[model samples]
Each structure stands twice: as structure tokens, then as C-alpha cells.
Target chain A: MSNPSPALVRFQTQKSLAHRLTLATLTGRPVHISQIRPSSPTDPGLAPHEISFLRLLEAVTNGSHIEISYTGTTLVYRPGLITGSSPGSGASGGVIRHELPAGCTRGVSYFLVPLCLLAPFSKAPINVLFTGSGVITSATPTGDMSADSVRTAILPLYAQFGISNNIELRILRRSNVGAGGKGGAGEVHLVFGHQVRLPKTVHIMNPGRVKKIRGVAYCTGVSASNNARMIEEARGILNSMTGDTYIFSDVSSAAYLPSKDKSNPNQKRKTGVGFGLSLVAESSTGSLYSADLASPPAGGVPPEDIGRQCAYQLLESVSLGGAVSLAAATTVLTLMAMGSEDVGRLQLGRDVLGSETLICLARDLKAFGASGWGVRDANTGQEGDVVVSVVGRGVGNVGRKIA
Target chain B: MEKARRMHSTQKKYRISDFARLIYDESLAPAEVVRKWRGEDGMADLADDHGPEEAVEEDENFFRKAKHNDDDGNNNEDRLIPKYDYDTLAQKWSNPENLESLRQRFTTANLMKERNG
Candidate 1:
């Protein structure tokens, strides 16, 4: 808090902006990112969703400063303490209400996942209620997972880091993407009550056999039969592989959004009508792999297609054969890096390790002054599973350190 | 220590192989992972995969969950016990593709591939 004009970590491009910001927040560093969509001519600068995320960061944190250029092409951010819904910091009743403006195409997970990484380090319990027209709970074509997947697949992973208690991702109201993939009238509540001094250093080399499969088939503003059809098709494909499979059905009415027409501004219109599926396969050793698929807002594909494709996607994730799936790799690795000053090991599939996103994250960590990861081949039953050893930065929860 | 000492005094003999697990699959309880075929064009009935050894280590809850999959009684498609030919398994021991598929199937990949359909 005493440092003035801290050295800024310079980065280029809008790609992985959220993760870069997340790293900066965790490391208590300043960042200057330029050329955010500068190449695009028609509509340039930071996207709407990115701006929403920056606003969210400002809400959950205290004293964080952000400066965007006139064109929004260049930006500088000086991160502050993760206050997390404390009193007198724009939080009402221990809750930070973050609203997404209209024209946001990404799903709510785009915000929730990044916010989760920041929550554990916050000064107080983090409870954020996302209520807005732009919160698409369902998976979008943009590849963000459904809110259900974030709950079932991703949130449970915090337990491994000893940050498990009082964490809940409640989907108060569900909605799929509206027309033009712009918005959904959904309400989601995230409670991250546990703040730890340091995450437990872990060694997860064994990806045991997936023993059971649990999932949710949800339909909003559509016939409940859509859930049935999806479950049937998915179960049909997955049953023969392993008999222990159960998919729950959730049917909800469509979200009512205020009409945009100037003539009847008060009139409500039904929007974000769709169905989706989220499946999580849990291994005997507590490893989780998840898959999500939702019908497009344009609406033509049958529920069977979504179900079958999602089942295949789950199978594909399982086939990756690692202690961590690609979806959870970033979280697992980041937590490991923020852990105690010791080496933590995680076994990941070769493809998962070689993925561009993971590679970029490794480099970004290096830029943020974290130790390099040590990769060695795992001689386990599964072929090509590499064990990545990360030495922790030992700078976990700066607020917790002082308090 | 007491249990091992008492076991040592018994008439039964102990071996190192029994104490040492060769693989993670052998060490874990039988939760029944789906078999994935890795682009094998040949039809292989690799049912011994979840052989009698897994039957010994099977979780009762998992076994029960395996049995009661019927939302409706008409769903008789669940095979509680699958029948496999031990002869074919022995005959294919030397087959490279069978061994390769077995290795691939055990790990979590290429499950219920479209090749079968």
C-alpha cells in the first residue's frame, strides 16, 4: 500500500486479459496493457464483457485504480487489496451487487471463474449477487461453460486447496442467451466465505477411474420433455460405458425482460428461451472432468443432438487422462502457484499441457515474477501424463497476512 | 504392526507381489470406468477389462446404483452382469492391437467411439 508509481508489467493484446489481470491482482502488481483490439477497424477497443469484468474487479476490491485511454485501446491498472464485500466499500449487507450491461455475449462463467480466483485472497467473505439482463447462465457459443458446470465441476475443486467452507454458487434464476447472443435475464449468487492464509501444497498425480457420472439437464421456457430427451440420449450413450450415471432434470420458466420498444417501455417480454446440459464425471481419486452444451438461441437442433454431443464431449475429457482436466487446469495451477513456499505437483495430459492457453499462462506467471514450472513425464499407468511442479510464490492473501 | 505380526504367525504365506500394487487401477476401488477404443477398426470384445478382480473390489453403493438405473421398468437395457468369452481373451493375448486397445481403454480415452456404431 505504501508503494507509489510501482513498476508496471507491460503486456500486449486483449487475449487472456482476464487471466493477466487476475495474476496482477494476486501478485499485487501494476499492469499496463496496450493494443486491446486495436487492429479491428469497425468496432475497436476493449469489448463490453472486458469492461464489465474491470467494473467487477473495482467492486470486489479496495483502492484498485484503472485508467483506460480515450479509444479504450490502452489501459493501466494498479491493483489493490481484495476487500470482498466489506462494509462501506460499495457493498450493501455483505453483498457486492454486480450488474452486467446489455450487449454482453459471454456467459456468466466468464466473470464467475475469474472472480473465484480473487475471492480466496480477499479481506472479507466474498458474496456477490449477479443480477442483470446480460447474465447468460447457460453456455454460449463463445465457449463459456454454464453456471451449473461452474458449480458442479469447478467450485468443488477449492476443497483440494483447503478453501472449501461456505462456498456456494446458487443459480437463483436461469436463462439462456437471448436473441443476437447479447443478453439473458438471469440471477446468480456467488458466496466465497473461506479466506485462507495459504493454499495447501498438493501432489495430484493419480487420475483414478471415473466411478460415477452426475449431471443436470435444464430447460428454460421450454417443455420439460426437452430435459427428458436430453437425459435419455446422453444416458443412452454413457450407460454402456459405466452403469453409475444419473442426470437430474431442471425446468424453469423463461426470464421476463423489459421491452426495449419506445412505445411500451414498461411492457415485459419473454426472452432467453432455451435448454442445456452440464455433466461432471468424478473419478475415484476425486478428479473431476466436465462438459457443457446448450441449444443456440436461433433454435433448430434437437435436444438429442445436444445430449449426444455433450456425452461425447464428456467422454473426450475423460480420454484426456490426467489428474486435472483442461477446464480446471488454470485454477489448479494458479492455486498451486499461490500456495506455500514449496513445490506442488500436478499431473496433466500432454495435450492439456501443450494447449495454447496453458502455455500462455505459464509465460504470464513468469512475467509476474513467479518461479518457472518444472515438467517431467509421469511414469504412471496413463501414458503421456506430465507432472508439472510449481514452486509457490509464498505471497498468498496479502490481506490475511496483515489482519 | 500387530495385524501383520498375527498374520505372519498364521499358516498362510505372504508374498511381495500381494503387498505391491502394479498400477493405480489395481489399487483403486472398482467404480467402473467406460472402455474407450483408440481408433481401432477391428471389432474387439475386451470384456475381461473389468474382470473378476474388480468384482471383488466393487463398491456396494456403486453396484446398487448400477442395478437401479430404470426410471421406468421397461428399461431392461442395463446389463447387471456381462458375459464374455474367456477363450477369445486368451487367444488375443498376443494380438498387439488388443493389448494396445487394452492399454488405451484402461486410461480414460476414446470411450464408446463412433467406430463401434
Candidate 2:
């Protein structure tokens, strides 16, 4: 019932907004971010998608306070209690539904990344229904996160932390930007069961050799033939490296299409339709690395290029030679920093050591009173791998009931 | 116009530091700040030497130091732009020597006996 003290952490510009907000929620400490592109020439402020993200964060947390300057550059956030599914809380079973119309700007992975980190510590189960851009496209351009990448890459990484059984991420519909037709705005549902215990420590020293590669080639409003073409081209490149490669073709039926008939005025309007290719390679040690590409409306990049580019991206990720892909490593590290008081170690590609995402993650961890360190593995040397270790602050789910 | 210009300049003069202090004083809960400060300083040390009262003073000092350092850091530029060089990555992967180095990652290549055994 007593008020928690506030900590002032200042950020110079608009960077890692999601990580900053997520850490503030977990630590229950207010954050003050200033400057926020104060040096930009024109129209400088929080983007519309960032505002939508803030609204989504506010919708989930109870009694959270947010302040912004008139120019929308600086922001001050005081996070409220992270009451998940606790009874008598405003959210029932800690389940909340957020309808994001313009979510296409950032893609669902932007929100999903942080939600995955906070879900295990919620007082109750957390369920979210997101509707917007489902697959990454040129317009949405998977800015370091995408639904396909999250599903194919991140879920397996979470399993190593012992937080796997109750988590579900299902895609109800798929859509792309500027793909006009009957079915557009993608729909995805995520559910997380409450955690009785904090995440377990993990040691991923060697990501065994990749054994097989699998993928999903899906199409909506466009011709289903686009899916087949992508699969053929992608397999052509991957087969040279591994013979056991299978990319399945998936076409959404009319039922998954958004209701656009004038008779049903209240129904959500379809955005557009297109096709996409998502590929994931599984290593013998259960690590997953993934890549994806999507076609825009007619006159965009050719299907062959999309497929070839995706294949090369996968090759790039694999060649980095780590236990997990560069995309999922940040999520795994964030969860490790927020887990129980034990040391967590992971082997990541050398490239990730200098990534902006990792740097922001380190800053966010510091904000949460946790520290993480990365060093080259002595056995393999610099080019081989970078091992990161973090000792969790033992942050408990205060919202959970004592059984 | 002169009055409006004067108002704008005055607002800008307040600076981010002043706004941060205002938010900290008005929004932050006193107890949460101490707990966060102690957590950052390591609870074991706090438990050993000082009581909660002294921890509050330490928290204030931490805030002042944080504010002082905020003005000098120009670390935001690289953080805004992605650092991945895809062209170089493509070139590296295209190299025959590099491809040979990772041949063991595939199923056709022989797996290490210790791993499979």
C-alpha cells in the first residue's frame, strides 16, 4: 500500500523506447527520457507507432502514469503494478485485448518482444490479441523483429529457460502492406500462463551443427502460385548446403479474411493481401535461426529475388555461427537479466557484441539493477563466439498468490 | 510576436534536467527510489553497513551523478542507425574458404563423435 520511490534515468534521444518502457515496468521504477531527437530538423517527436505502443503498455499496467512535453520529444513514465491474472485486479485472469489498427508501422514483434520478457512475471496469465501487419513487408520491414522470426526463432530460445509449456502464439490471419484485396490486416493471438517459479539458468556453449531446415511459404490475396515459386527458389539455394530442406505452402481460406461487406459495418476492414516466405534452420542442439521476405503489390521485387534474398539472409545468420540467431539473442538476454538469482550464459555470434540492440539491452538491464557482461570465448578465440553472462537480480512476481 | 518569442525562449531555458527533477519529485514514490538505489548498489553491502536512512542519501547522490553525465554522452547516433553491414556479410558468405569452414554444420558432413555418441 506504500508508494515506491522513483529513480531518474535520462536518455538523450529516441532510442530503444520499447526496452526502456519494459524495464521500467519490470523494475517498477519511473524513467525520464529527454531530448528525444531534439536535434532533428523537422517534425521531430515520437512516431505514431511509438504512441500506439505506449497506449498498449498503459492498457496492460494498472495505475501507470505517463507525461510528455508539448513537442512530444521528452517523456516521463511511472510504471504501475504488473498485476497479471490476479483476482480483483482490473484485468481478468490478467488477460487483456488490444486492437492496434496502425500497428503495421512497427510490426507485432515490436510489442511481442517485450511482452515475452514481462509475461512470466505477471501475477496472472497474459493473453493479447493483436491485429495489424502480421508478416514483415517492405513497408513494415521487420525492424529487428517480426512475427515469423519470433515464432521460428524466439520460442525455442525461451524453452531453454524452462518457460515453455503454457506459452502460445497463433496466427489467425496474414496480411501485408499495400496488398489490396479481400484479406489484409493480419491477426495474431498470444497467451502466457502464469509462472509459479522464475526462469531456470541456461548454458548454451555450442550450438551443434544444423541438421535440417524447415519453413512456411504463405499467400493471402495474391495467387497461391507465388508461394510455390518462393519455396522452389529458396530450396534451390538451401539444398546445396543441406539436402533435408522442406518449405511448406500455406494459403488462408476465406474464413480468415476480414469481414468487409457493407452489411456488417462494424466489422474490421481488410487492409490488403500478399505472400511471404519464412525459413528456419534447426541445429542439433535445438537452436533455431530464421529469415523471411515478403512481396509487395504488383511491380515490387520479383518472387525469385525475395526467395534468394531470404536464403542469403538465412545463410548470413547461420554463418555467424552461434547457438541462436542474432534476432532472438536479444530476447534471450533480456529474459536472462530478469530471471531468478542465478547465472545465465549464452553463446552468440561475434557480430552481436557490437549491435545497437545489445547496447540498448545492456542499458535497459542497468536500469533494472541488473548487470550483464560479454567476453570472447577463450577456447575458440575472437572470431569464433562471444559468451554473455548475467546474474539475475532475483526479481520475483509480487502479484502471484502464495499457495 | 516579441512576447511569444520571449515565452518560447523561457520554456527552452527550463532544460531537460529541470523537467527530469520535476517528474522525479512529483511522480516518483519515495520508497521505490530507495529500493531501486539499493538494488543498484547491491543489497548485500547495504545490509552490512548502512540502514535505510543512509541508503536514501546514497540514492540522491546517484541521481545527481546520473544527471551530470547525461550532458556529455553523444552515444545516441549509432544507437539510432543499424550497424549491420549486409554487403560485407554477403561477400564473406560467398567466399569458398568461408563456406568450407562451416561445412560441418550440415547433415552430410560428419558429426563430432562426442556430440552424437
Candidate 3:
């Protein structure tokens, strides 16, 4: 047979789409661009969302395609070991507007892991007081997400699914009290969050699957009255939740109240009550849910907006972490927020506020700028129910400018 | 020398940390803190030996009020009872002057949360 056709030499090859998916996987050093597409297309941005859909389709059919974005901000560092000085610049902000080529997979390898690692480092505990409500303006480009705005937007979703047997809600009000009496402009921000406890049978795909839930956050501010006498009265009113009394620290330690009672200097201030609410809900996704504001204090300015802003912020914080798999984070955050009692627990008396000085010995302690540290129980490490004194100091070069 | 030794034993240097520890331990305890500059061990010792000078009278008055006359267990228990209960008992021991009816208002608010969970 003609010498068996010289042992007919035929070569065949089978390639897999995993070469594309290699980029999306959380791994060190993404795949090289040349290995997959090996060539740059003339027009990459054609049908943007469709391209993503197609890549996803290819991933599902022929394995998976590594996803990359073209519209991201460009991040560049002067070739050196030193980390760049300004991380705030828009560089490396988002995926660019073009179709992420299979070649960009290599960049993904370098980027994804560090992002996952550093996400926790970006946020430290912050103690803020809501003095009044203000608009949360958008900072970045249109597409760039603003957490504060996202939080404000999601409050309706959470409120609609109110707290139930499976839900536990807690709210914290961070108000910025002013030096002037009540009429002085003060901002009050509300943080509302809830937790929903779920039974084991809900998630059967995996026995160890965690239950999912949602939280709401919002912020609002109101100007206090300038009447000094009323301000003092308001200041004397203790937080209904925590019996702690607050003193008005006027600008320049000046006790002059605009709404001062001419007869009695001590009666110059008015007190304002800041309100916060916590809400939590959990269910198997299609449960009809309903809720309303809990019994609020009778007749003063109702703290309706502050409560909404708080719930909004919490939801945004969770969403930024990830679209799904956010339940564990919500639980941890709820626990952290509820971990301590507010100043509301202490009954105010001059004797209780005795001249007590607390000298804290901080070794290897790190603090964000001006963040107040509560006097926690030394042995148990829980926050003490009472805050007798607060002292903090930091020194910076005279010439340094605060951003 | 014996008086000085006694003074020293009763006195303790007052530091913010020490006061903080005391305050955290119990909010009601009146802790006299005499601020001593760092490295001033001698001053600290002196302050410890002779408790707070300025607040001595105030301390005495407080101690006098806190002084319990008898160590009887029943007396202590009677004193430990809430003031509202004490006022009712004071009118007459075992007096059925409609005293027992007032005790129901002190029901615990968290009874449901603990029970439901």
C-alpha cells in the first residue's frame, strides 16, 4: 500500500478556554496576553457589555474566560521599590472602557490578590457623632462608586424588609455637637443596621453555607437653636437610651450662648436628642416583609432622616466588599457595632463625673487621626459602661498642612 | 516611725492608670488621685503615706456616711434591699398596710428577650 503511505503523519491539537479564565482566578501573576489572543484587535470596545456577556458565554461553554476591563484608570509608579506617595490619584481606579483582552489576564494576576489582602487595612474603627444632616456629594467620576451615596440609596430596600423574629436591629447616632447653643449648626448622622438569624435548612447546596442578610445606613443634620438657655436645657437632658449627660463645648471654650437666659447664666443652653435605630432581616429571599419606625420620643424634631442615612451607609459598606457572600461580613460588623454600650448607660451626677484622670499607656498602639479610644475594661477588654474622662494629644510639625 | 509606717501602708500613689483601674472596677468608689510627675517616686511615696491633703475632710465625710454600724447579716441584707422596698418595710415590719402590692412594678424589661431566645 505504497509503504503504508509513509506512516501518514497527521497532527491534531485541542485547546481549552481555561487559558482565558486563568486571569479571573485569585492567583499570583496573571497569564500573559500573548498566550491567548496573541494579537491586539484594531477595535476592542465594540459592543462593550455584549463583549463581557460573550466572554462569559465562552467561559460557560468552553470552560471560562479571564475577564479584564478597558475603562479602568491607569496606575503608574516610577520604576522603583518605593510605594507611590499619592494613592488618591485616579490611577488604577477602575477597569478601562475597552474589552479586557485575554492578554490583560497577566495584570489580573498581579492585582487581585493584593486587593483582597489590603481591603481590611483600609478601614479602622471610627467614632463619629451626628450633629446635623448634610448631603453626601459624589466625589469621583460618574461611574466611580461613592459609598455614602450608595448607602443613602439602599435604605428603602432595607426598611421595606423590616426586622422580624429572624431580624435584630441596632442604631447608633453620631452627632457633631457645636460650641454654640442649639441653633448653632450641628450635623447628625444615623447608622441603622439589622441582623437576621437564619435556620440551617435554607441553604442546602452546601451544609456549611452562611445565611444572608441586609443592613441600612443614613446621615442627617439639623441646626440647633441659638437660644442659650434652651441649649443648656437640652444639654441637661440625658440620652434616653444611655443616661450619660453631655456638656456643650463651645468654640474657643467660650460659654456664651446666643440664646442665653439673661437672668441665669447656667440656663443658657438647650438640649437636642439625637435618635438612631437598628434593623435586621433574614429570609429565603421571597418572604413578604414590612416594618415601620419604632415608638419615637413624643414631640420634638423627629429624627426621621438621620435614621435613614445610617441604614444607607451600612448597606453600602457591605456592598463594596462584594456583591454576594456579604452575610458573614454583615454579622461581624453588627457584632462590632453592638460590641459596646453607648454613653447612654451612665446616670449623670457631678459625683460620677468626679475629677478622674485616665492615663493610657499605649505601646505599639496605632490610631487614626483624632479617633477617640474608649476606656475599655482592662481585664475583660469590653468597653466600660461609663466614660469618665477623655484625653488625647498628637504633635505635628508647625509647617505641616492638614489636608 | 510607726505612724509614718501606718500612713504609708494606707496611702497609695495616685496615677491616672490607677484611678482609671479603680473607676473601671467600680464607678462609685471615691479614689483620691494625687498627680505625681514622672520620676518623682519620693513625692509619690509622700502622697501615698499621707492620702490626699486637700480632699481629706471630704473623704472623711464620705467614709462616715458609708460606715455600717453593725456587721449582722440580716441588717446588711435589709440595707441591701432597694430603697423603695426599705421605705415600705420601715413603716412597720410585717405590717399589712397594703405594702406588698407595690412590688409588682419592678418587673424586668428584658424578660422576653432572654426567654424568647
Whose TM-score is greatest here?
Answer: 1
True contacts kept of each: 0.01, 0.26, 0.00
Candidate 1: tens digits of C-alpha lDDT, residues A1-403:
5776679999887768988899999999999999887756766788888999999999988999999999999999999889999999999998889999778888899899989999999999999999889999998877788999999988999999998999999999999988988889899999999999999999998888777899999989999999999999999877766678999999999988888898999999988899999999888889999888899889998999889778767766776678888888998999999999999999987656655466667778888988878877788836656788999999999998988
- Per-residue C-alpha lDDT of model 2 across residues A1-403, encoded as one tens digit per residue: 3556755766656667877888888777788888787765665777655676787777666778899999989999988766554455445455566666542355566677788777887766777777643333222343443466577777767778887778888877765654331113667777877464567777777777788999888776667888888888888878878888988887863224345477986675445456677889998788887876666455367677677767777877787776867777777777777678888788876545434456556656765678645454524422446576778777656555233
Q: Give the CAPRI rating of model 1.
A: incorrect
Task: Give the 10-residue window scoring lowest on summed lDDT in candidate 1 chain A.
Answer: A350-359
Question: CA lDDT, every prediction?
Answer: 0.78, 0.64, 0.23
Model 3: lDDT equals 0.23
TM-score of chain B of 1: 0.20
| Best model number under lDDT | 1
Q: Report how large a share of the reference interface contacts model 2 reproduces.
A: 0.26
DockQ for model 3? 0.01
Off by over 4 Å in 2: A1-3, A39-43, A85-95, A132-139, A142-144, A179-184, A253-270, A296-299, A372-374, A378-383, A401-403, B1-96, B111-117
- Residue-by-residue lDDT tens digits, candidate 3, A1-403: 1231122111111011121222112111223222222222542221222233233223212122234345311111111111111122211232111122222201111111122111111121111121212111111111111122223222322332232222111122222222221111222222222322211111111111112222222222323322232223232221211123222212111122334467775655422222222223222332111111211223243443323322232222221121112212111111122122222111111111222212111100111112233332222111121222122222211111112
User: lDDT, candidate 1, residue B111?
Assistant: 52
User: TM-scores, in order shown?
Assistant: 0.79, 0.75, 0.17
TM-score of chain A of each: 0.98, 0.87, 0.18
TM-score of each candidate's B chain against the true B chain: 0.20, 0.25, 0.22
Q: Residue A219 deviation, candidate 2, in Å?
A: 1.8
